[model samples]
Target: MRKIKLKSISIAIVLIALMLGSCSDEILVEEPRGVFTPDFFTTELGVQGGLTYLYQSTRSIYGFAYFLNLGETGTDEYAAAQSADNNFHDLDLAGQGNLSSTSGFSIGRVWGTSFPAINTASGIIENAEAVNLDNSLIAEAKFFRAFYYFLLVQTYGGVPLDLGGGELKFNNSVVRTSVRNTVPEVYTKAIFPDLEDAVNDLPDNPRLTGTVTKNVARLFLAKAYLTYGWWLENPNSIPTYPEASRTDPDGNSPSYYFQGAYDVAMDGINNPGPYRLLDCFYDVHVATNDRHEEMLFYSDRTEESQIYNEADLGWSGTDGGGPNTAVWMVTPNYTTITVDGVSAVQREAAQSYGRPWTRMAPTINVFTETFAEKDLDSRYDATFVSSYRGNWDKGGDTTPTITAANGMEIAPGDAVISFLDDYDPSVNYVNGGNLGGGEIAGRSDYVINLNEINRRFYPGLWKLGTYRTDNAGGLGSPNGALTRPFPIAKFSELYLVAAEAAVKGASGSMSARDLVNVIRARAGKWCYDNGENEPRVEDNSAAMVAATPAVVDIDFILAERSREYFGEGYRWYDLVRTQKWTEYASSYEIGGNSASDHSPTVTNRTIQPYHYLRPIPRSQIDDMDMSQAEKDAYQNPGYQ
Candidate 1:
């Protein structure tokens, strides 16, 4: 595990510019008393500052911001959590039509933001070498630059491979790279080389300071290779109207970039890197505790990565506030599942699917399908809560009265237990039991029931703000307040990714069942042997069941992904890669309503092939100097 305390690179840059006047008096070669230009910060400190700037951008990687926004919307992740106000609306109403033809909203923002980041990284890399900064720091900057460019290639096709450093000032008239480079070309040309150098130069440990470590480099390298390969080899995952497939309507078959996607991705995975999946059981809780892990390449913190808070539930807070329910419905609840028939309580239970303006609750269909899997392997219980409700095991106040933060005694009136009985009865909201019918404070249209309760997570509401601690001196919850329980990252995913890479790369015959068994072993559970076609479940007590490896397949891995990482924010991507988008859409619905089906994050619902890769931003299209046919082909259908 590595930890790097990053500097505020942007702030440092501004300070340097202010001190260094642009207009230089040629009289004296060495400028005035306190002036410093690109040459001044080009020192070790300056390079370090620059590296930090690249990471600062990572803070924007959540549901509403950037990372998941593009990935979640218009994809299975988007479709999985579609709601009226979340990402689905943007995709449905704004991004409805063709990929090459439409200018969608977020699509444009991503394009604009990505390049600035690329240039920032490029600036650091260029400046570091000019001043001869420490080799390690230079490697860190290079890794960051490569990371951004990789994203650009993946998202916008052949983005201008700007190695221009700080020399090029910001300008809107920037041209798209002469032609889109193939994914393979971009990887070989940029990503692989940088990472190879990075692994050599970066430190072995986190050092509790902000700097790219060997682990981070290794993780990114692995991810880049895994994804590029997966995207390329699979025909369905590849964009249908690939940048290569389109022509000037003159019938010219443009070059495709899939090979690059494959090779570099393969390199990252098989390279003699020290990175490997940290054993999930031992490492999962530890990773969350210190934000330390060999697999996590980046994490975001806006002055603070708040601990889990239990009070907040609905979505009505600051921007980048909590997990957007719209894109997080697929995450499993940690509290309700059992070990050998005894509930394996979630001691560190925080919000998995976050608060919501648009509640992206799992559909009865998703729940049903999940249940069906549980029927096959009771181990799937580790994926979802066995019951949506739990007992209110309050230490002091056993009577059911919840205290407010302001020391106000609030008694929930006539609250109906809003959960299915078999789950848990003590804590659920019941009709007219307390809090006056549990009527959503303002809206009375929807009643208090299992759906709404489950939408909010039945047992307890968690947030980044609330963290529970048994002792006053403890690291588990620095604040000791109840915050959202969002597992921004998890260990189970590493196993799954490894499984995908192994299967696709043909690196090894690591069966999906073997990988799954490893994950279950960590979670203190195991898949049962039902011995039937309909996927039957055999009860295995803490004492009895023997571990037997089953045949691993894509479908099994997918089910595992859905169960384990649902709301942690990668379900939709898994669905798309596995071509389960339409199948999932046909089954799930809006805010837990089965019949009122809608797009996952976007509004209108339709799964078109062109949508696999989002439409290039509408604004970008208008700015492009392409031919009419090219422009027509790229126009945004959903843009208003």
Candidate 2:
């Protein structure tokens, strides 16, 4: 872990200026420098500025590509793409590279950034009481502290609660000596208490948009309970770090935590404050509707103010710090697609098309099995870009009309490439023509059947794609970092949490199937047809609710989670919490990386028992003031 030092007072000044500047059209540029004094945080300005910095710190993890790779690459939802580097291959566990303490995996970001934020939160919390700051403001600090610890415990097993001074103390001096806390100790002492206090002290509504609220605290507290319940059960016998027992320190059984999770989730659902599910599933992900009521908390980003955005709105060459570029990893290279030997889909700074790095691709089972009900479920259409339209004019290619796949004349805005919703045997396949797969007989666009999807030519992630308001009449900056906010928590997940807990034998008023039916019913509503590119008014609620199984299981809930939250950096945590990573992701089928290789390749991942907790980052181990033996012992079992 990097040394946690006191942030200079100038950071607060610069952040406050940016916050104030966001209200106007002017952009402010300022350099932050100065040392911290004991009296700094006692003032109201210091406390508020520290709080703002805490919210901004999330950008280092949430929208970053490296951290996204750690969360999604090793799981069943995605695998290394054709152009993936060692940063991706190391985590795939497919013999491309080894995931060791020395590997370049970005798990270190969670460790390195969280501690400093925790210390900052600690500083605000400790001094705010002295200054008689409102409890709600202090509650925000508590919420952030717990949030970072929750992320840490999940990623690195157990981390240091005491940084230099004491447990949860605000230390201004640098400290290299550290001790790992037990998972139970970390949860019982830090996470649970802080979140419980936050739920009590936080306001019903946020004072600022995207700030923590009572419901956000409740959501996380319930999720923490659910995850702890799974850890206590230890159903798969996965080993934990620091060699601790799988018992809650409070003497509660796993069922108690499960029951706790269900009750809390139900509370949030019953008394939702300015939060409720969006009517249609498509609305939840639409770029223009990003700040809708469904999102509980998110890492905020904007193209309106470059100062508040903390990165350039037009172009970004680096993925460091505040760039929201994780979407680039999953986007297919649509600009290479052609129609009638002319480049058809030019890259644009729109939600449908973005810069493509081709670092990760979805598994074939994602289309064939997990989302088999593509037509009835609007989520599949909302989640992916299945059609590439001709925008050659935007790229200055003035070929007004050209003969397409079926010798049909096509103009601009016509379909260039369309992925079939299901396999069509009548489609005539060309082995090496275009990128991959075949074309339909009478269609003007080239078509790739569902089974023929390859690494080079799969559906791009539409939900998390690029969005820019400044693209005026031409191809704008598709290479820029996505300016949309990356949602971290949503209100709809409460239903899933309640249902999962109910399935785990937590007695509740709503049955497991009843709770799940709520989400299924929502999935059936559609206001927009993403594939057809038109408005659609349809409700298949009865059909969707009827399809639900009479009995719900963990596997069912996991599948629903994938359908609801695919490629959103939630897969690894979900799989690890349920101990389903090995069973579900042992093998996946996808075509070879080459443009012409459409044949499915069965790739097997070598997941082991100790791979559950990622190796302790080598930087953390090296920076600690400990002997070589102590460092070796501090590392996770397999890595050492």
| Model 1 lDDT per residue over 133-203, tens place | 66776677678767766666655554444322112222222243223344555666677678778877976
Model 2 poorest ten-residue lDDT run? 5-14
TM-score per candidate, chains pooled: 0.62, 0.95
Give per-residue CA lDDT, model 2, range 1-640, as digits (tens): 3233232111222243122222213322322424344467788766766777788788878888776688889788898888888888989998898898877747577876788788878888999877788898889899999999999899989877877668888777756667788899889999999999999999888776677899999999999999999999999999998889998887899999999999999999998999999999999999989988999999988887777676787777555677888889898887777656787788899888998888998889899988889888899999999888778898898889877776778788877777889888887766312666466767777778767677877898999888888888788988778889998999999999999999999988898899999999999999998888899999999999999999999999999999999899999999999999999998988988876666788999999999999887786778767789977888889895
**What's the number of clashes in each of the models?**
83, 1
Clashes of 2: 1
Residue 418 of model 1 has an lDDT of 28
Q: In model 1, what is the error at residue 81, expressed in angstroms?
A: 7.3
Error of 2 at 55 (Å): 0.5
